[model samples]
Target: MSAAKPTIAVVDYGMGNLRSVTKALEHVADGRAHITLTAQPEVVRAADKVVFPGQGAMKDCMAGLLESGLKDAVLEAAANKPFFGVCVGAQLLLDHSEEGDTPALGLYAGQVKRFPDGLSDAAGARLKVPHMGWNEVWQTARHPLFAGVADGSRFYFVHSYYMAPADAALSLGYAEYPFAFSAVIGRDNVFATQFHPEKSAAAGLKLLENFIAWDGQR
Candidate 1:
């Protein structure tokens, strides 16, 4: 008899791009694991791994978590199992977000900060807000989830606020938008990315592939 496959939960709190995140996971999972898009806390807590994804305003995201009663589940999963956060999901893992003076899950000690105005690149050209499009993510340390992914590889990004962990040692990856910003943050079983790996191409797929195989170790 074969062993039962691991269960990977994609948390749905009515804010994230669920279909894209789910599809991406399914693509990489390829029957190695069972991927579920769920709002039920019981299902989430019972899963072997959890993927928390979000987008749009921080206020709405928090409100949705409360409305759906999945906030505690997320916290529990992050504390006890492998957790992967994407975009606003990554931001929510921190203590707070300036996006609406909103409080978050506090999974990590940090703040989500907005990009300052009057920004300019090296050529002195004005940079846009939201920082849309693809950007290279530079690895800060060797990690299991980062396995097989090259340093300085580009990933898709579309956000104004960036993650700023209180402990600089928690910073695992960085990307520049005129200046350096936190693109990935993690410790132990929790890992997060500000960019959308599902929307990114080959590099993104590789990252997802790595996550499926990761054992949540340092």
Candidate 2:
């Protein structure tokens, strides 16, 4: 008999484009796993793997997690299961965010800060805030989720703030807007990306594919 497929939870905290996240996972899973886009704590906690996805405002993200009562479940999964965080979902894992002065889940010790003013590129042109569009991510450390992905692969990004972990060892990848910033961060079973892997086309799909197969180590 074949083994049962894993149940992967795409945490729907009422902030992100859940359909896109879910579709991406479903595409990658290819029937090897069950993808659940849910706001229920029980569903999140019962899943074999968890994906925390976020967008919009930090205050709203936090509020949605509380309102949906999925915060504790997400924390539990991050601590013990294979968890992946994307965009604002990634930021919320930090200690705090300059966006709305919001306090985060504190699973990782760090702050999420906005891009400073007067930022200029190498040619000295002004760089835009939110850091929209595509940017190349320079992987800083080896992790199972990075399998089959090149070191400096470009990923889709749309955020004004970036995670700055207290421990530099937690940095998984770096990308530059004008200066290098944490593009990916992880430790243990938890992995996160400032970029939306769902929107990153081939490279991003590859990442999601890897996460589905990852054992949550390193």
Candidate 3:
């Protein structure tokens, strides 16, 4: 009899697409763990690892969490378990968001902001606001999440808003889109990314594996 496998929960708050995320986790799990998609706070609280994946407006995201009554559970998990946040889920960890002027979970001291319009690159070329498609993520700090992941790995992104942490130390990855932006942020048990790992291919899976193996330590 060996140690029991870990149970990972992909939190579902009826905000974004949860199926793709759940399927992705299942793919990477490979029978090494149990993957669950849950909106119940109790179920989430009991999971060994938590993956909070979200997209869409911050107001709706926060509303979904609250409406589902999983906000406290998520907060508890963030402070306790090995936690992972993706996209809007990552943004919710901040203090506030400009999207509908939403007040987020505030797991970290920061704000989620909308990218400025009419922005241009060095060549006076126009850049989109949503910043969709695949973009390169440059690691800014050394952490287990980037264990097998290269310093500059491309990940799928789809969002109009981005985060800017008050404490720069919380920023672990950066991506340039005409201007530099924090693509990843982590500290202690919490690790988050603005991009979608499930959609990201090999590098993303590797990062998830590292997260699963992480013990929530420094």
Candidate 4:
């Protein structure tokens, strides 16, 4: 008998860019996995894995989450199954965000803050806000999600704020700006990234493939 395909629930909290994420996951899985973009609490709870991808301000995202009554459902899913968060969705896993002074899901430690001087070289030229375009990510720790990925690979990035986890050990990847910041993070069954894996091309697709193959046991 064939093994059951994992159902990935891409949470739709009104703040996420779900279309691209859904398309990317579908492409990576080659139709082997079931992907759903939904705002229903029951749908999230029933999925084998959950993905929270967002693009927007911290305050607005949190507000949508609460108003939808999907916050508790998300926490429950993360506690019991494999969970992934991207960009602002990943930032929301922390205790709080300096953006709009909003409280987060507190699933992980530390806080989120904006890039002080924006991206800068050693000489200190302003690289601009939003931190748009592609950047290299240096893998810092071993995780199943990075199974076939190389140490230094370029991924698509577009964000202004970054996360500072209470425990550096939880960090899986780093990228340089004026200084290095956490690029990917994983702890137990939860995984997150500051970059957009959907937009990262082949390397990003590999990451998604690993997530789909994960059994959530380790």
The TM-scores, one per candidate, come to 0.97, 0.97, 0.96, 0.95
Task: For residue 5, give model 4's deviation from the true position in Å.
Answer: 1.1
Q: Evaluate all candidate structures by whole-model CA lDDT and list the values in order.
A: 0.92, 0.92, 0.89, 0.89
Candidate that beats the other on lDDT, 2 or 3, i.e. the better one: 2
Writing each residue's lDDT as its tens digit, candidate 4 over 78-169 gives 78888989999899999999999999999888889888864678887878877888899998877888888888899999988999999998
lDDT of 2: 0.92
Q: What is the lDDT of candidate 4?
A: 0.89
Between prediction 2 and prediction 3, the one with superior TM-score is 2
Q: Report residue 99 deviation for candidate 2 (angstroms).
A: 0.6
For model 4, give the 10-residue run with minimal summed lDDT: 1-10
For residue 104, give model 2's deviation from the true position in Å.
0.6
Query: Model 3 — TM-score against the truth?
Result: 0.96
Candidate 1 wrongly placed segments (more than 4 Å): 1-4
Where does candidate 3 clash, by residue pair? none
Total clashes, candidate 2?
Answer: 0
TM-score of 1: 0.97
Residues 136-215 of candidate 1 have per-residue lDDT tens digits of: 99999989888778999999999999999999989999999989989999999999999999999988888888888777
| Clash number by candidate, in order | 0, 0, 0, 0
Deviating ranges (above 4 Å) for candidate 3:
1-3
